[model samples]
Target: MRVVSLVPSLTEAIAVSAPGALAGVTDWCTHPAGLAGVVRIGGTKNPDTAAIAALRPDLVIANEEENRQPDLDALRAAGLQVLVTEIRTLDQAFAELDRVLAGCGVRSRPDWLDAAEAAWADVTPDGPPVTAVVPVWRRPWMVLGRDTFAGDLLARLGVRNLYAGHAERYPRIPLDELNAARPDLVVLPDEPYRFTRDDGPEAFPGAPAALVDGRHLTWYGPSLAEAPRSLARALRAARR
Candidate 1:
């Protein structure tokens, strides 16, 4: 079965589980190292529908949040079968991954998926929950708010998002307001915006900053298996 994946996480999952099944993928699908010889449709937000349709894929995988509706509509209007997934929590991610793989003709579950579930299942928080402000973007200062997959992941790891109750899933706040929140820790992921030690921590002043892998914190694929350990280590390192 030929597949075109618009979502990076889904692309990695499909590429790893069913090698060579993908005929096309977005330019953002950067995992599994050297992904060569595949058609690069475009970016997630602005995919080239005509280029994708020309690929004649049996399935096009996408996410509700990562992809735009008009693009999905354009693909469907061109007679392409697009599978759109919604994942706001860990459970949803696992289930959606199962569904996506099944749609890709993977009858048996991948070992990595099983291991990912097991990894999260064995998690035990080392101490009380740490209150943190998670910044996904820095220029305008957007943060993870309510009903976000990243926020849910952090919650499972015993880090409570200060903006988890905010009306917006990702709200842009002023710099002064963010510092005023006075979170115990500042969690920075290196994607959407790259927040390094020198770059991000200075703004938070007294708050310790945990610099983490954005893929582990955001992507819901094979990375999930190691996210628990890697994220825990980063969080622990910040305290040390």
Candidate 2:
């Protein structure tokens, strides 16, 4: 069946599990290294609906948070089936992956999915509980707030989010305000905004800053299998 995936994580999942089933994907679907031939349907926020419709795909995979409602509505209005997923926790991610695969007509679970489930099945947060502020973008500085998959992932690792109770999922707080909160650590991932060693840590001054893989911190796909360990190591190392 032909598919057009707007979510990067879903694109990687579909491309890896059901290869060749994807006829179109957003330009940002970069994982698995070589998705070169698929039709480029622009970025996640601005997918080319006309181009996606032209692909005549049997399914279009998206995420509620990553995609805009108007675009999904337009796609449905144009007679395309779109599967929009909501994942705020690891368990939700596993369940959603199963549903997405089933919608694509795959009856059996992929090994990566099983591995991912197994990876996080018995996690114990290793160290003392630490409070953190996770910045996703720099310009106009936005941070992870309230119920979010990334925050949940960190929570699983014993890192509590400082703004997890905030109403907005991603709130644009000024840099000075974030620094004033004086979290035990500042977790910086390299996507949504590329926070590097020199770029993000300096802003935090004396606060411990953990530079982490954005995919491990945010994306919910096969990478979930290794994320728990990968992020834990980074967070632990940054303490020293």
- CA shift of 146, model 2, Å: 0.5
TM value for model 1: 0.98
How high is the CA lDDT of each candidate model?
Answer: 0.93, 0.90
lDDT of 1: 0.93
Instruction: Please give the distance, in angstroms, between residue 199's alpha carbon in candidate 2 and its true position after superposition.
Output: 2.9
Lowest-lDDT window of 10 residues in candidate 2? 197-206
Model 2 spans > 4 angstroms off? none
Q: Would you list the clashing residue pairs of candidate 1?
A: none
lDDT of 2 by residue, 1-22 (tens): 9999999988888888888888
Task: Name the top lDDT candidate.
Answer: 1
Model 1 weakest lDDT span, ten residues long: 197-206
Q: Model 1, 151: alpha-carbon shift in Å?
A: 0.8
* Model 1 RMSD, rounded to 1 decimal: 0.8
Query: How many clashes in each candidate?
Result: 0, 0
lDDT of model 2, residue 205: 70
